[model samples]
Target: MTTRSDPVPRTVPPGMADGSSGGTVPARRRRRQGGERSMVWLYVSTLVLGIGLWWLASALGDNALAPTPMEVVAAFGEGVRDGWLLDHTLASLGRVLVGFVLGVALAILAGFLMGWYRLGRGLLEPWVQFFRTVPPLALIPLVIVFLGIGESAKVFVIFLAAFLSCVIATFQGVRNVDLTYLNAARVLGAKDGTIFLRVVIPASMPYIFVGMRVALGSAWATLVAAELLAAPTGLGRMMQAAQQFLQTDRIVVGILMIGALGFLMDRLLLVAERRLTSWQEVR
Candidate 1:
């Protein structure tokens, strides 16, 4: 009676008792967050390092050919103040958007047909290859003659650049679709149209996006060349004029702006690609 009943021992759950499994999830999350933060710092560091190198080079050279970063910044600000920068940027952006949309749309349609039907591919592949081998810039003279040295000519060149890249990409994507998936869809009693829409498209989207990214770069390059050759107002035109006057700072500004815009667009496409292909594991 005085000793009382022996106290009952407590038993913890397996994972909880060890505190291993229970702590794992939080640890993993922390690691993921740290990785993301490190990536952000890396990007920032890269930009800073590049600019520092550029500045150092300019300072050491002390020449007009290699204008300092501050000089370029001043020129950029001056262009902004003069309203020319905004105008030229808008003009270039408009052409790129229009050309890109038209080219991508047409390429998708053509690519689907060529990929799905043997006869279509036989007939179209030759022409596609021919045009693909021909640089879009090479067609500028012919386009200018036909469409004149106006927006039409410039847009046509950009369109051709985007179209060729996208068509090739879409075609390859379709061809690369897994036969196992297609067979599985057939087993599931999926019709041709349904399989194409659901199975084929989703599976091939990564390739399509790859093509689109390439096309975007091509379009920008073509646009710049077109503008330099004939545009009354655009980044290319601005840079060309600056070159004539030996305004190295302005030339640098234009180069930076073009690079920045292209980089931003590419990033946007990459984000879209990730969202759309979320079901698939990407490296």
Candidate 2:
């Protein structure tokens, strides 16, 4: 009778009283917030440390080639105030954007064809591989000869660089798509076009995004050489001019601008990738 006097009612935590996950959800949210904070601090610390080291190097070198960070900043401000910096930046940005868009469009088309069809692969892959083996810089001379060192030549070189970098990746992406998904789609009565649209496209998006990022980097890397095509107003041209005059600060400014712009563009692409591929699991 005493043993059967029954166990006392167990107390439940407030959030778990009704078997709800309210407490655990908040804990997970806090962990995420904490992780984000840590990431932000890490970025800030790295930036500060880099600047400190750069300043120290400049102080130690005390040479024209090793201009101080403040000197570079001054050069940047002067360029901005004189209006040339904005113009050159815009010129470079415009060329890259136009060339990148066209290159990506053509690459996607060519990659899809080559990846999906044996005939297309046999016909196009050899040429793609050959061109890939050829350095973009080497093609600059030919580009100038054919396109006449005009804006067209610059854009063409940039486009070629982007296209070559992206096309291979795109082709691989399509080829690498899981066959199980394709078979599933087929079993579900999905037609070729429907499967391509719904299954293949979504499945291949991560690879396409990777290709796009690679293409973007290629485009930027090719910019300086592209602008070497008798360019008058661009960051690359500015750097070349600064180099001839030994304007190290100005050269550094140009370098920083290119890096900043490239970083920003890449970040934009990353954001787009995360948004579009949210359903894909990531670590």
Give the clash count for each candidate. Answer: 0, 0
lDDT (Cα, 0-100) at 239 in candidate 2: 95
lDDT per residue as tens, model 2, 1-283: 3465777888787677546665775666578789989988998999999999999988888576778999999999999999999999999999999899999989988899998889999999999999999988898888878889889999999999999989988898899999999999999999999988898778878998899999999999999989977899999999999999999999989888988999899989988998899778665
Q: Give the candidate number with the greatest lDDT.
A: 2
lDDT of 1 by residue, 1-283 (tens): 3775888787765556546566665566578679989988999999999999999898888576878889889999998999999998989899998999899989988888899899989999999999998999988778877998888888888899999999988998899999999999999999999999998899889989999999999988887798965788998898899999999898888888888998899999988998899778543
For model 2, the stretches where C-alpha displacement exceeds 4 angstroms are 1-34
| Worst window of 10 by summed lDDT in candidate 1 | 12-21
Query: In order, what lDDT does every prediction score?
Result: 0.88, 0.90
Off by over 4 Å in 1: 1-34
